[model samples]
Target: MYYIAHRLFAAHDRALAAQLAHHLALKVGEHQVFLPFCDTDEEDLVADIKGRRLFELDRERLRSIRALIAILHGPSPDDGVCMEIGYAAALGAPVILLTTDFQDYSSAPAGPRTVFPDPLLDALATRIVRVPRLGAPAQQPGTSRFANFAARNHAQVQNATEACVEAALQLPLPLPTISVPIRDGSTVYAEPSSYTAPNYALPGRTTIAGVTVLGPTRFEAAEPIPAARHDWAAALSSTRIVVDGSGPETPPGAALLIGAACATGRPVAAYLPRSTYTHATGREPNHRNLMVQYGLEATLRSADEVTAWISG
Candidate 1:
């Protein structure tokens, strides 16, 4: 399966993204295409999604994906797409960065056809394919932005779309196997104490239900930044499972780590006690968001369940 990550917030972007994804689907198998904007097609920002299920749905779909076809554009490329690329790269999957925008970007030594400014983000690309932007931008407003461009440059759009599909078809699927031993006796790695979780104790336990948990330091430097992303890279590879054992609540970092784990096609499980999640009036809801809910292989509520999940 090929996961298509593109800008999804605006109508202009949405149209272009849909058109490109549609063409890619025609070239590849229809079942292979997964786009996050499917529910947002009518541009209903308010009424469409509930409880952030969209994020969970997309992340879940991204799991076990054969490769990534990420579209980069705008002054600042979509942060979500960049993360998607990084996740796919971590899994050692072939990433084809596709761009059809007319923006004049600098050819940095960092990445091929560099679209984004950050060197770290650019380094994730396995290859780059730039579609020649043929028509000029539409000056008028009211659906003319992407619609006019599409209408004026029909040939350009078709060719570019096919070019992207061809690039994707050349790559192998069911990505290569990689083996890394679990560090220590850990069956799962929990969120580190580096980032503060407002509602719960961070790295809640060293072990759950007799299964050893890895809580290695996420920072390599004196500061709290993920300076040691290498540690996570190794930890993720070493462990068979990555877990969000934050009990009552989840930290942002846990969400990020687990999503990365899912992106690598690793099975993950979590134990978020239901009692702690039900909030009183005026208090923030403590339930697990759908992102974690969807990413987890098992949603365990007790220590007893942890061992059983791990054994599987």
Candidate 2:
């Protein structure tokens, strides 16, 4: 079965997602495609403990999906979608990225700076399919828009969905083997921009709490970050907490860190602005993505807090 991974927050986004799923079903036959928002219980997503139930539900659903039809839109694609893509790629499932929105609001790569979709995300997907800009078809006038106007017309949407379906049909799944690049671990893994700026620093131990961090290759200075770069997969194994000080005001890059971290059983700790998100858990990280909001262990408020987290 094919899975449609998308954002379901905004009214237009919801409409667009529903529109995509509808179009996809027309081409591939009914009851074959699964859209998360359409299939899952949203009420249960909230009532469950910290949304762990939804997390588990989605993980299991992706495990069985044949291909991932990921909708890439907005300044950045949905973080949940990114996590979905990462999981699908790990399972060796084909990921067909379909986008009607083509604009890069993000910056060039510098430190953890994210681009249109972070290079890391670009690396994971099997292939990308770009559709013509979406807008109401010429015959249709003033389509009711709840949030933002629909960018692509009906015909373009049809074409994009068709292309995605064809691509999914052609790609091979469950490849015999997949290659993943690995980087040696470091005790502390912070962006090059972060180290010089003084967000958090280890007190003295190259090894924290007996975990040979990121693994064995210890870095305590500005120079190491550049060498290590942002290979989150390789780094997460060795690093305890990835300290990202870039809050929403700056639009964090490559969010793959969160995806890769979760995929590999690592905890990502970041300093977030209070303006982002606040929850019943007073110490929860200020994040927009429910996955990040709940999966995150804590928000680092000070160097002492960082040290305390790393040590424990």
Candidate 3:
């Protein structure tokens, strides 16, 4: 059996967690699954906190589980989830951290401060999986909440849940380390010529062995404009032969950098968001245009596809 720990503050989050637990239980049958939110029925009462029954029960559950699967989202994870992760790690269970939110933890900044995964959790995780967002943003008028939630997250939840189960089963799953480029798209329209490589979030199944931010564009202060240009060129020289995320619709300067990468005879690929593709090319994705203009070997749409490509 595996323990799935997730935040249940929001109604949607609770709903999503239930679906994930159910699907995971079905996939890994016979071995019981424990979901904290799903298993516990007692309301959290502050006045009766001294009883400590809930805490004790949770700890016992944590100790018995073979593995822990944690769902992280938003800018940061809830404090309770963080503690649960720590406790599970201390108990020596394998930890699987999954999220779709990508935040750069390695690079120094050229702009404002940003959030990254917690270093402790990052170190503790045995496997990390990135997946696409579960469902559409807008709610249909007649759809029940569970139906709507299921509709949105069914595919991603199933995929992630299966991966978690595989890990629990001690099956081999590839954890590939990838290099990702950082670009600032904030000024794409305001200063089309200005180029700055801010930071990049490398998403994969394992920790990045190392990340070399190509140029003088460390997380600190920026170099002179010319110096920065030199830095951009330098960064490209150190980039991987197969770049995972690069596209022209990024900030203009960043786009040019990607172009430069393509020009270097290296293969550049992008997981083009619908809006980004529309914004960049002003039309739907045409393979011919993607190749001729963006220099992408392939334009991927999901993390699973990207993973298969990287693993391939």
Give stretches of model 1 more than 4 Å off: 39-49, 101-115, 135-156, 179-312
Cα lDDT of all candidates, in order? Answer: 0.57, 0.57, 0.48
Stretches off by above 4 angstroms in model 3 are 44-51, 110-116, 133-154, 171-312
Q: Worst ten-residue run, lDDT, model 3? A: 185-194
**Residue-level lDDT tens digits of model 3 in 100-146:** 66464433444433232323345456777666466564367887888
Better of 2 and 3 by TM-score: 2
lDDT of 3: 0.48
Counting clashing residue pairs in each candidate, in order, gives 0, 11, 5
lDDT preference between candidates 1 and 3, better one: 1
Q: For each candidate in turn, give its C-alpha RMSD to the true structure in angstroms.
A: 9.4, 6.5, 20.0
Runs of candidate 2 with Cα error greater than 4 angstroms are 26-32, 43-50, 104-117, 132-152, 174-176, 179-188, 191-233, 236-246, 249-254, 273-275, 278-287
Where does candidate 2 have its weakest 10-residue lDDT segment? 215-224
Model 1 Cα shift for residue 133 (angstroms) = 3.9
* Model 1 Cα lDDT, one tens digit per residue, 148-194: 77766875666666788888888865567654333444456554322
Task: Evaluate model 2: give its lDDT.
Answer: 0.57
| Residue 131, model 2, lDDT | 71
